[model samples]
Target: MKLYKTFTSIIAFLLLTSCSVFEKNRSEQNELAYMKNIEDVAIEVSKKQYVNLLQPGDRLIILVSAQDQDVVKVFNQNYSATEQFRESSVPRGNIISNSQPINGPTYIIDGDGFIDFPVLGKIEAAGMSLDHLKQYITSSLKRYIKEPYVQARITNYRITVLGEVRNPGQFTIADGTATVLNAIGMAGDLTIYGKRDDILIVRNVNGLISKERIDLTDAGFIDSPYYFLKQGDIIYVTPNKTQERLAKRDPNSALYISIASIVVTIIALIVRK
Candidate 1:
């Protein structure tokens, strides 16, 4: 009777340990599963789209094109076709001979939020959207070229994602606009251990830094201002409690399991004897 009780106790202990290995402390909330069994539910779409404004230390690619390429050549000093003339004291109207196209033009905004154009001189760019800046430049060129086309874009638009994700790193946004979900997807999505109900985002707009926490499990997060991420945004996926606990005791778990297995085998041997 004593041997039987000892065997039963060992079996119960082994069962508990094995079950603990697979036990997870996940939250009760479901992931992005809120819109179910509801009829005719519609959210008012926001008219405002997130636009990235120009800021200091921003690199830009401004290209001016026209029907008459030769007439517009003087205005495009930064263009590869006319880049060689910038170093030389060549007259603006006089085109340089045998100029080879090598590299694209890049305009860096100074600390004072201004860029010196080839002929327009210094112009305020910070606090202005890309479309606004393009309009300002195009309006200025009306005196020089008829139907002037100005193309402007921020070249260094980027965002970073970190923690509890498959891949965490800074991702460059080619289209100049991206959502929080898009940024997360770029980082290879959050891990199973990541907290879906609480996502953190750090944003910097016009020198003011702010932090916002969002819940991915709720559909209402789609209507939040942070749904569309801006330039220089940082996303961090927080780890769940289960992950934290596992991380703290993961190294010792193997040791504990090995010791338990040895003790169980020894007990079996003693019982057989």
Candidate 2:
């Protein structure tokens, strides 16, 4: 009878301990899922399209390519030799120095938001798209170089991510097409406690600063105008109270839970024996 009682007690104890551990894990998973849902909402809210306009102090890389060697030479001679030019050209097509090469003509916007091209003179580029800039340059080049192909791109299209992200810093987009969700992905997504509904997007347009709050929970974010990120845009993720509380309360919750689980299992085994 004593042996039987001991066996039944052990079984009950073991069952209770197993249930406790299972419940703890389940609670943790649920909390994690809820936090993830918040992050998803923020990402969804940032899916709106955005078009970037040029501003002063913007750097542009303009490349003019052509099939005719003489035409290419004339075009090249028009602009000052950039760093890329000094590095790429070799004698007899054999590389002499593998050092860093100079690149295309660096177009710096003057105080009037205009760049002085060799043959094009001073042209206003601010508030113009890449295509617009290309067309303007192509029209001017036609007067001098025949069959000239012009390509223009913004050399500095960067966005900043801050708050509740794994990594916070400035990131440059090579293609000039960056979205808010894209910035979050670059920052390693948001932490578990980050509030998805109250994300902040800061934008600077024509020297005026504006701020907007975004909620990521709704699927309608795709139609929002802020969906695309512009140069110098900033994305900030705020943390929820629950996450802050969890962080503040019981700094050793994970450790305590682990120790309690082990202790419970040992007690059950002893009782069984």
**Highest-scoring model, lDDT:** 1
Model 1 lDDT on a 0 to 1 scale: 0.71
The CA lDDT of each predicted structure is 0.71, 0.67
Q: Cα lDDT of model 2 overall?
A: 0.67
lDDT digits (tens) for residues 132-218 of candidate 2: 888888888877777788866666767888988878788766446666677777777887667676779999986899888776655
Tell me the spans in candidate 2 whose CA falls farther than 4 Å from its real position.
1-50, 73-102, 223-225, 267-273
**Backbone collision tally, model 1:** 0
Error of 1 at 52 (Å): 2.6
In terms of lDDT, the poorest run of 10 residues in model 1 is 84-93
Kindly report which residue pairs in candidate 1 clash with one another: none
Query: Which stretch of 10 consecutive residues in model 2 shows the poorest summed lDDT?
Result: 88-97
